[model samples]
Target: MIRSINVSSATLRHGIIHSPFRLVTKPSNGLRFCRVRPLSRPSRPSIILARLYSDEKSPKENIKPTELAKKVLQEAAKRENIYTIPNMLTFGRLLASPVIGYLVVTHQTSWALAVFGLSCVTDLLDGYIARKYNMQTVVGSVIDPMADKTLMMTLATCLAVSGDIPLYIATLILGRDFLLFLSALYYRYISLPPPKTFTRYWDFSLPSAEVRPTTISKYNTFLQMIYLGSSLVFPVLSQSITIETAQSIGMALKGLEYVVATTTILSGLSYVFSKDAVKILSKPNGKP
Candidate 1:
């Protein structure tokens, strides 16, 4: 019977050329003959794999990967302008944080409360203006949360030092914020565009990454604000208000402190586990 045998691995010592496999096409007189041919595959560098694909003829024709990333980032930058009334108000609130802390530390309770109230008003005003006027920018996204955290840290530190808030709770709050700050720095360094330099890294106007605060994190910030604000305002109110009202309000705040502690732990953990907390802005392929 005429038949064909496949010889996948047959070492031929006499030949110098190496093929993947030898195929025996025919058998005759109890002997098999096969042909050996090298299979050639065009080698493509892995670095070339990062390609921006849009139109069928787009990336394959003219533009390179790094150039396309710059184009996309530039387009993003155009859409997000840093100058806006809301962003200005947020910057003002950030600046007021240290003043409030200083006032608290110096035992100027009335002055601290007044300035803190103004800062809170600006915080609310900035966010409302940003959403209503469509003045959202990448820098705003970063600095808004930064301002809030700065206020919280300043108040927590000042209150803890003055023996107003529990030292342990202050420690937890500062520790979590410090961890998040380090993480943000690391992400900014890695996600930054090419030719990353000292100047470019510090320039917040350059849009590179966006942080979408989680739902729990939002609640945590609100709770922290209430906790810190009450810590400042309650004593001043206690002197003027009735004894019964002071006792009741003090009880309510005592309970809130525990709630804030729990939420602080949860919000910090949420950042670690949540997938979309921080998003790196880039093309679908070849992340820049």
Candidate 2:
């Protein structure tokens, strides 16, 4: 027969059977459990924090702080009226000039063609957009033409070094640019204050030269770009196509080159002997 007894504290006081607790306790299978205190509720601040953070978006992984900084800077630049779209395009071309030259020297004809093509497109686009929108800055007047000159000089030098084009042609092309650069410096030196060390090193400023491209010079530049582009592209195409086809294209480019050379020489001479050029170079004393 099974027996069950309800023992009070008085019965447990004798220590005949050990009780685990001095207060209320229970026993089962020779183990004792005392009454447990309940856990306290979370603090108000903790609850508020949990609720506040619960719906927040998880932080994006693999995002660089520098990248975020660059984006913020770009937005700030837009607001500050410095990096307008047309100026950005001109700056891009300036940056690309060296890469194009490198590609030409390394015999990466296809890539050179692609880069030169893009440069041409951006050149036209930047000028058109600037004029159409009336967003021409004083800085753009200096930088846009400088970018064009730099790209032309780079391409001419590379082609001359590679022996794909005659050395005299490159010399003629670059000599014109050098003369114009000197002319600009001469004008600015007379007109403006002496430059700081940094500005002097670059030889660039807002008021450098306001010389617009002569119509003949514009055609000359177009022809020069065409000649350079064709020189890079034809060699690559010849590798895939027949020699006869390549020869025909080569003859056409040669013909174009002659026209370009003639125009280039004429434009340079015209620029040097122009009334404005004479005035800038031979300024009268005490005229101010």
Highest TM-score: which candidate? 1
Models 1 onward score TM values of 0.71, 0.64
Candidate 2: Cα lDDT at 7? 38
Which candidate leads in lDDT?
1
lDDT of 2 at 153: 95
Residue 238 lDDT in candidate 1: 91
Model 1 lDDT tens row, 138-171? 8888889989899899999999999889999999
- lDDT (C-alpha, whole model) for all candidates: 0.78, 0.69
- Candidate 2, residue 206: Cα displacement in angstroms equals 4.4
Error of 1 at 260 (Å): 0.3
Clashing pairs counted in every model:
0, 0
| Candidate 1 backbone collisions, by pair | none
Clash pairs, model 2 backbone: none
| Poorest stretch of ten by lDDT in candidate 2 | 12-21
- Model 2 lDDT tens row, 48-76: 33332322323343334455444444333
Off by over 4 Å in 2: 1-82, 193-208, 276-288
